[model samples]
Target: MTGSLQPVLAGVVTALVGFASSFTVVLAGLRAVGATDTQASSGLLAVCVLSGASAVWLGLRHRLPISIAWSTPGAALLVATGPVAGGWPAAVGAFVVSGLLIVAAGLFPPLSRAVAAIPKPIAAAMLAGVLLPLCTAPVRALVEVPALAGPVVLVWLLLHRYARRWAVPGALAVAVVAIALTAPPARPGSAGLWPVLDPTVPSLSLSALVGLAVPLFLVTMAAQNVPGMAVLTGYGYRPPFGSALRVTGLASAVAAPVGGHAVNLAAITAALAAGPDAHPDPDRRWIASVTAGVGLALLGLGAGVATTLVLLSPPVLIEAVAGLALVGALAGALAAALAEPDAREAAVVTFVVTAAGVSLLGVGGAFWGLLAGGLMLLLFRRPRPATAPAPEDGGTVAGAATPRQPGRRPGRRGVPAGR
Candidate 1:
């Protein structure tokens, strides 16, 4: 009984930490892409429930600690991309398309391989570029609203040094207190406390498909799903890649009309459930993930309240917490983007182009950054020279002078080659 309770508690912690740390980012992204307050709330509820459902299903079926989450990086990408040409409906359409693409990648080996074939440096560079602006929000918040943002930053710093896992949640708690003190009080029954689904009729557009859908898909795959598989594998679990993709993709599609962007496997938080900390016996760890799923679904009931608080708080204050949560991600992405010395130049170009936030022909910076980096790599790649034929029997060709030793020179004396 005690052993069973331990995983349940760990699962509770995982759910609370995961939701508190980055839900602000999700709301901000939906708002950025033209979702209204109500829509954003509904979107948040939808994703929490859907992702939790998927996690529970996968954990029970595979008996592995297969955690699932809404694509936080993909949300950041939406914030960076801003509003699409045809407004929120178009963005919804794009979400549907991205979900279908994920399904296709699972079903079609060639499509999955094609996405995987993208150069690592370029992919990491693009993600870093997308994340750069959001990661800077903490400092900006401090400068802009010192009293409100200072306490949040200070708590985050101190807790980060000691209880690293709880740093963001600690900051979020402070931010909430700060908001309650300064923000205007809500009237009785102003915000819904229950989960509600508000659906939109999706409208497709070429611009949204290219600018929003493609980048969203790429970011979710590279930043969330791929790393999630790695995390599970590191814990000695065989991740059901195809099934997971299909589940998440289908969930994303179903939830998009309700404003949820995307759902994928959890990367950072997966460690909490899959690691030994969740359970001493590896076989029983799936219980932690299952409990986490249920806990997350329960948390979805508070989406309306969370959205109300965000709506009332100073935008930068909420952004500061989200930004702090992403700083580690930005650092990891930047490190990966520059890891290969040979690809450094191309990677930098990708980073610069993406970070520029420029749009061309209705396509966003991410796609263009990849194109520019690929071009740079192709254009600058140097071919290896052909090896010279070996001399037969170690004999020199006719009229060829004897080769000098490395320490000997041509000037009739034993001189160093450098000299």
Candidate 2:
């Protein structure tokens, strides 16, 4: 009980942070895609439940902080494709495709290798590019609603500098309290809190699926799954790739019918919990992730409460906190990407292209950033061969114990040949 308490507490905090960071993004994306409030709420519930379960299962197995969540990039892409496509049914097809792509990525070694080979500079550039819009959104909202947006921004800046770890959640708390105190009028029919859990029968259309599914799948794999693997490897834990992929895939498949679009490994949030604060023993930290899973599942059980919070929270606050909290990650990731010499130019190219905000074939800049960076490296660099040094005094300099020249025996230097 003594040793367990800290891990349990750490896990609970991890889940709350991860949920707070990701849940609003998913909800906003769904609403943009034309989901009714009830539909969007249900979708978010499915996402949290699935993420928590899979993260716990994986974390318990590896004893690593293996967090899982809905794909932020996929949600962003959905914002674009959802309205163009018919509705939720089309989105489901996309979800299935995303799962399939993730599975394929796990199974294919070459793809992983190629992805790993991407220069850090390029990856950083791409990440910065993706986050740019999110940063501006809050400022834009401030123009529309200064009372709510202005305070949230100030809170975000204060927390980011002084108490960054709590910035987003804290700002969100302040915004909620302020809104409650103000008691703004709610538009009729917008204020109800019920989210129907009755699963809708699955449907598919080839045209809609092809257009929507391909992009969604690509976004999930390139933006979320690839980076996720990078995060694990970067931190020195080599997960069983096949098992992780299968679990995420299975989780996504199960959750889709209930409205979750994609479920995958969490890079940023998992990294936070995996750090020293979560647990001293690397092996023990998984308990935190497992705790998060259980907590998420419990939260799912009270879907009404979760729904109410999301509904009641102002969009301006969500944007401000999310953007400011993520500012640190964006900086860190970009620095890593840019730190290396050989990869610098290509990484810059990837960053520029992605930041340009050009979307081709429904794929976002995150994917293109890596892709362009890879191309730049291929075009510019050539692999050099390992250098083999000549032996000194007939001894192999490359760690061979025996003398290379037969009769020229061993000696510290010119001490005549040894017997």
Candidate 3:
């Protein structure tokens, strides 16, 4: 019973950590794109519900925590370019295009196979690169507001060293406590449950279609969905690609309007939920995602209340907690990406570039990190065959050693044995 209880606790913690870290970024992105209070909450709710449902559904079917989310890169692209072209409408259209591209990639096995073939180390490097900025945000905020951010940072460091698994929850608890200790009061506002229909209608514009839509599409496909699927596969789960894709696409289509821009597979957050510490069985860990989804939906439905809670914390406090929560995931990804032999070079390229935080032609560093690493692999490396040569014969060895073809047998070369 103690052993069983351990697994359950681990699973719950995994879900909590993954949910907390992933949602912070999503909320930040939504805010960056000008989502109103209700809209932002609703959009976050959509991410929670969809990500959890996908995780549960995939876990039940293939037994894995395949928690998905909106692509951070997509959001970065949106904030960088969506506003420049046509504002929210352009963002919505970009999401639609990106979702469709992801759907299309899932439907095409060749593309999936190609993405799957990328070296794991390189993927990890790219992931590390992409998440580095996110990880640093809290510290930067701390410099801005020490009174609130300082305590959270101190506790986070303590938990990270002594109670590794509790790191995220501990940091979050400290932030909540600090907020409770000293927060400015807020009065009731006119913002309510009203929905906006403006973002629902897609507007066709050359600037948005070329700049925002194209980059968003590419990022969702190469940077988000591809690595997400790899995380599931690495954990020995074969989630039905089509079902997950459809859910991500549908979620984005639904949320694109009212200021939600994009949703796809989560890489860093998904890793937190999919690893062994999450659950020993891996079959039941979907509970975490399920629970998170419910929480997210509630947050969306009660956007006002949720906003009140978020607003209660000093901005730096929230940022610090969010950054602290990601420390474990960042460490794990870096370790994994650097551990492999064949993937070392590719991974290094990815990590440095992604962490560089460069943006070019409306694309974020995440997308470019993957692109550069993949190109390096293609240009310099050959695929390592799964089997080696047979000892007696030159023929390749497979599942098991087979008798060499009569004519090709080493001992019988150039002549039939009995003739």
Candidate whose TM-score is highest: 1
| Residue 222 displacement (Å), model 1 | 0.8
Give the C-alpha lDDT of model 1. 0.83
Query: Lowest lDDT 10-mer window, candidate 1?
Result: 392-401
Every candidate's lDDT? 0.83, 0.62, 0.57
1-419: candidate 3 lDDT, tens digit per residue: 35445544544555566555445555555655456555566666655555555555555554445566656555544433324345555555766676666566556656545544556667667656655666787878778878777777887789878976566667777777777777754543334433222235666556656655655665565556656655555555554566676667767666666555666666655555555555555565555444444444433454444445565666656656655655554675677677867767888888887777665664556667878887877787667778974331111100011121222212211111111
Question: For residue 94, what is the lDDT in candidate 3?
Answer: 64
Candidates sorted on TM-score, descending = 1, 2, 3
User: How do the residues 323-379 of candidate 1 rate in per-residue lDDT, one tens digit apiece?
Assistant: 998888888788878887878899899989988888887777888887898898888
On TM-score, the stronger of 1 and 3 is 1
The C-alpha stretches of model 2 lying farther than 4 A from their native spots are: 80-82, 114-127, 183-195, 198-236, 301-314, 333-419
Write candidate 2's Cα lDDT for 106-164 as tens digits: 66756544543444455455655655566566777688778887877788778878976
Pull out the clashing pairs in model 3: 70-263, 70-264
Q: Tell me each candidate's TM-score.
A: 0.89, 0.75, 0.68
Ranking by lDDT: 1, 2, 3
